[model samples]
Target chain A: MAEIKLNNLTKRWGDFIGVDDQSLHIKDREFLVLLGPSGCGKTTTMRMIAGLEEPTAGEIWIGDRMVNDDLPKDRDVAMVFQNYGLYPHMTIFDNIAYPLKVRGTDKSEIRPRVEKAAEQVELTEFLHRKPKALSGGQRQRVALARAIVRTPKVFLMDEPLSNLDAKLRVTMRAELKHLSRALQITTVYVTHDQIEAMTLADRVAVMKNGIIQQLGTPDDIYNNPANLFVAGFIGSPAMNLINGSVTDGMFVTTGGTRLVPVKSPDREKAILGVRADDMHVHEAGQGDIDVTIYAFENTGESTLLTVQWGKQRVIARGDRHLRKDQDDVVGISLNQDHLYLFDPETEDRIEM
Target chain B: MRDNTLKYLLVLPAVLVVFVTAIWPLIEAARLSFTVGRLNRPGSLDQYLGWENYLWAFFEEPAFWNSVWVTAIYTLLTVGLTTVFALGLALLLAPGGRLRSSAQALLILPFAMSPALIGVSFRFMFNPEFGLFDAFFGIVFPPLADVSWLADPQLALAVVVMADVWGWIPFLTLVLIGGLASVPRDTVEAAQVDGASGWRVFKDVTLPQLAPVLAVVVILKSIFSLKTFDQVFMLTNGGPGTATQTLSHYIYFNGMKYGQIGYSASVAWLMVIPMIFLTYAYAKFVFRKADQ
Candidate 1:
């Protein structure tokens, strides 16, 4: 397995910049995920590593070789495209055997290797069938089988599960995790699905506007976001960010009401970031702040209450047993240990 | 009022038009071939010939066989050359940037010229005294300085084939470009990442997807080549001891120049046989593609 390193990689098309100058070092046998919304340059970064796209500036090193001028065939990397990119005219057996065949492997060694790879992906029975006859998930498995048929130096996957149906996506995601663990190849996966990055990545690099906002373990990023963007982007139901000012060591809402005590010097303007699960809902006037519930939603495992806090709605997760309707007064208490304060002007987190 | 009835009814006008424009002429030609239909002798039009014209052309006429041989070689040369050159041009133009797209747009200009005009231009270009190609070839090869291209039998046929190929390449290239565009881009990229080189990707992925389109191009070009007459008429006029005479030229000479309408009609009917088979094969490919 090979480690991939990007040194100040940049990609530009005329005035439009696809990827700005950024550096990343992926360790050997590590599963690094590039996670971001559309147009965030995650796929462009992976394509550069695959030698599919030429970097406008900077160096890409795979193992010890600087593959800046290498063709895709010389890169010794296998990629699974978002559309699976299966050869529609070739059978699954030939599709998987193509890399080996093109690399000048012996004929006798091809069939057994193809069979073994197909078996790994559980596609032994569909070897003779063309990709057009297979379902989306089956085609995706064929793409995976093609990549794993030959042990390449690295594996690059660009949202390989994005095209499948929701149920099949989850099943395939689990299979992918198991397969990646079994193979232990250096993999760089790109995805916009936060759950996939959280589950599949050993370390996730969250990107925005062609820059990495945060690169850390999934737990670390979720538990301790570095900035306002990461804090708002990482959690489910998104972290609620309330605008307020820190005065007399207490955070005051814009409506001139004192909320919670924070251990920070007085600032003219600050934003408080809190996750949905961090805020506890209680009976009216029983907690820190009394607010009317704007809406209540039961999501089976937990009930979520969107309450009005100083003219802004903040979602709070309560027990599944709790039932509250709109206009119902609920007491909301901020968990001080989990609260994050940020300067409104800089949009950077202020460590308390 | 039903869907099935409405669909058939909608196609009725087209069927009637085909019958009037196509089927009627074919039936009339077949009928005229059986009679001694002479343009110069009106009284002989009703005289029953009973396949004498066909038998005469098949056995007694060496000139008819000569035309057949010339037409066969011409068709083969033009179709093969046009397809090879057009496919190469399509490959070059298919990637599509500003310069390549402009070149592609310029290709249509040659196709827009009439085949008769192209033939006339080729004749002027090969003129021995003061022609562009003649002077260039004479200067490049001094042995050909005094040679008259149109005066020689073999050279005249080659010039005719070249003219036909040049005139048809632009149209065929445009069609093949459309075919190339329809091949999935991802499949080619996938082949590249699968460790195949540039040429291998084309051979394995691009060519296989382009097979159906190439078949259409070949069949269409063959039919057009077989029916070629306008260029030959304008350029050689079946001269140089009838060296560049094709089947259509032979039929025209027999019916119009010699007034042997019945004999020409029989030869024309013989030519239609090959066209029917080609049309049937083309229809099969089109329908099979639709099924997919």
Candidate 2:
């Protein structure tokens, strides 16, 4: 079993830190996602683990070996790049057979193993064709089959699905999930898309500015976000962070409305993070407060109402059948249990 | 005018320029090749000889066959040696930094100097008594110190090949550097992470992808090497007993020195045949890449 450990790993290009003193222990057979915005060091961390980028300080241990100075080939790792990076001149079968061939696998053994990997990725039928003749999705499958042909110690994927179209992305995401389950290898996946992280990762390490901001499971990170960035980053529509201040154990909007009470004491400035789904949509004056809708959108599955709350606009999700128009006044009420409070200065969650 | 007509009209100037500078001269040369064209006899320009000049150059001339052999071996040696050295230099200078960038900038200096000038300079450096290379080879190898580089038959040919290769490597190396740059970095990295050593990555991934560009380089270098004339003229003047007399030098000797214009034109037309095939091959690569 292979487990990856990065102990105080730091990568700096002059003054700009790529991965700043980061330490992470990924368990054996666990699929850990390094998730962040662009330039947030997620990809850099994965590259260092893959031995593609050298760390300026500290050690990287894969299994029992301190492989800080090992070359990428010597580390026994496989990576899927964003662009698929298939050998354009090679047939699909040859592409899948490259790792085995390079490792000096038996000539007779290469054919059947390549066929098996191709069958797993559903590329067996197209084995004779070169990569140039394949579609984008087929090329991506060739990359997948190549990585899985030889069972390397760890699998590293850098935004492997980012190049596909939206519908193809969904289909490939399911395929990737199935493949990772069957392979059961230690995988380090890097992506900026929170949905992929939430769906595929056993645990996601959310990063910002070269530092790991939070490390937890999907449910833990989604429901109990560690900071304002995580709360704003992990959701589909993104959690609504309303600007306000906490006064006398009560949250007050910037427009001077004394809203729901929070457990934290008074603070000069605070941000209240509330997801759109947490707020219920009721008819005018029937809920906690009546507000006019600034914009109304019907997403087919659910309707969204951007309501004018005092002076600021906060969105509320309604049922698919709930039809409302612009300037339509609707009543809104907060789910008191699901609300979160954060310190504006530190951007950290105010644990209460 | 309609769009189709306007498109052709816009390109008409370039077409006329090509016709005037290239096509017209080719047609005139073909016409001249069929006659007994001589400078002293004014009426001989139109006196029809009908394949006599071609037959003489093909069957009656021993010096013509000698030049052909010299040119064939010359093209082979220069193209092969230049491409190998250029590919090495391109790889060394491809991963550029400030020092390497200045080094790359320095490579352009030799290429900027005229070929005729390079041949003249090389002649001076290989002089037996007090030449730079003569002294250096004397100290380094001892045997070559007393040997006159331009005095022997085989050695003169070797010196000519060296001069041509040295003059051409900078341009080919720059083109190869561009080709190496266009090879996708992702594929190389993918090979590395797929358990390939650096040498294997180059052989398996980088070289295959660079094949088309390499083919283009070889074809371009072959065409240039076949047409080499100025260096041979200035360096040995086809000397050490005509050891370095290429096809162009042979034609110039027959046409300008002996005043046998029709014979030289027939031989020049014979030279044009190989060029046509090479130009066709070069066009195929250019169009194939465009299609992609």
Candidate 3:
């Protein structure tokens, strides 16, 4: 319901900084995910926006109002903590009704609101149960219900599904995505899990060391990473990065295997990035790189082939029907169009 | 099998100490309460008295019953005040930041002080002469000069209760503060975001979380208050016409002072019965409920 903007926000503890100078703009009704590794200040950024933590400097504006001085409740935001911090003494009914009660809603209005929120989370039947009596997934639903009952302008979720089992986490992730669209609230979710960020976010803000590494749609981040960190961090089995140089208008690895550039242009010493899906194995062809298979993983429907050339080993996803295990030299073809180049010293993207 | 035997051998010394120091004394006390002995009649082992001393305590001795009532009143007042003050201090101190450690250390300093020292200090302060309380009041009512607080029937008992509260509240507060500190910060933050005010957050989130610890504080303070003797003995010596006399003081008066060993043993038994019942009932009622 409100657009949030952080202008040079920073958080510090004595001499140490939790979140360095960072700036981000979250549009209204957009699901923006702050994704990063642990201790990278994703949660700290979310807490600052929610007014649960104070920023050391700069300002936070929400829907034209500078709310840096406001308390969490005054900021018109509801948060779902990673631990699903439900009051253990209160039943689910009271827990969901707490926000309404605090806001001085009418007695008649509170009942239906609580009921509607509970119904959305599929927790109507367990209304009278305490949090301790509920399972992990059920408790998360209660926490979600508690947030939705208020119908606040913004929803802040800090890795809310991280506590559930793998299957439950998947289910909850889908549920949260669906619920965010239905509620149409400006939501900022923080998670270290890239899969969750990829699936749940309308726009993912990849952060590292308290700074935004890349801020774009999932496809923009996955296909055209702005830097080496994003290119390496955003993908599974990750993008294969190898040190290479431009010679004779062809990208050549240190092992002297020449990769015919799909787009031949200008490049010197730069890191070459290629996705696993873009690479095709060639036994022998016009444009092929010879490499010996190091290992192969069969994951039911697909197989991952890890090949070593010189000191470099890169994993490529392939069809289970095509490749088996370690064998003789295999020929591989690279999708030159999808290849990314990064300057080795700066770790910054270099124009190809 | 060798490891199990070695583990048992390691704990043998602890088991022996429990048997000799704890269980043996309890058994001896039970046996002695059933027998009769006097200083002069120590050589004769045929002095067997069953429930006569108990009967005398309950019916024949009016002063004994009065002492019981006084002790009960003092214990209840001391425990009740201490529990209330301790819980309040814990709530105020548990949220610590920069000043938290200093505040906690200062609060616990009173408990670290010796009870005998506390008694002497309070006695001197409340003394109607050049003492603090009297001197402060003497500015208003100059007619009040050197009024003996320990000699007054009502003031003597009040002073003992006050001294006990000062000595014991810090201990209860420290325990409750540790318990309150463990109340999840996540739960409290959730409540705050849910639009709960300060009082509501404490009532719904903190109070329920601290129930088990508060129960412990109350029970421990009650047990200590019931057996209180140091402050009263050091200050008033159970004087002011038996006004400040507790059961422990009465037992001391009979056994050591008057040398009525048989009678004193009976009074001690009379006191121990209620304490045993209380300990059992408290563990069953409050502590068990808290565990759930």
Q: Pick the candidate with the highest TM-score.
A: 2
Q: Write the per-residue lDDT of candidate 2 for residues B27-95, one digit (tens) a residue.
A: 888888999999778888788999999999989999999999999999999999999999999989998
Order the candidates by TM-score, highest first: 2, 1, 3
Ranking by DockQ: 2, 1, 3
What's the lDDT for all of these models?
A: 0.93, 0.92, 0.85
Task: Kindly report which residue pairs in candidate 2 clash with one another.
Answer: none
Q: Which stretches of candidate 1 lie over 4 Å from their true place?
A: B1-6
Per-residue lDDT for B200 in model 3? 83
* Runs of candidate 3 exceeding 4 Å displacement: A262-268, A284-287, B1-16, B34-36, B40-46, B106-108, B130-148, B281-292
Error of 2 at A183 (Å): 1.3
Q: Which lDDT tens digits does candidate 1 get at residues B1-292? A: 9999999999999999999999999998898898898999977777789999899999999999999999999999999999999999999999999999999999999999999999999999999887888899899999988889999999999999999999999999999999999898888888888899999998999999999989999999999998899999999998798999999999999999999888899999999999999999988887887888
lDDT of 1 at B190: 86
Instruction: Please count the clashing residue pairs in each candidate, in the order shown.
Output: 0, 0, 0
- Candidate 3, residue A107: Cα displacement in angstroms equals 2.8
Weakest ten-residue segment in model 1 chain B by summed lDDT: B40-49
CAPRI accuracy category, model 3: medium
Looking at model 2, residue A331 earns an lDDT score of 88
DockQ for model 3 equals: 0.70
The candidate maximizing lDDT is 1
Question: How do all models score by TM-score?
Answer: 0.96, 0.98, 0.92
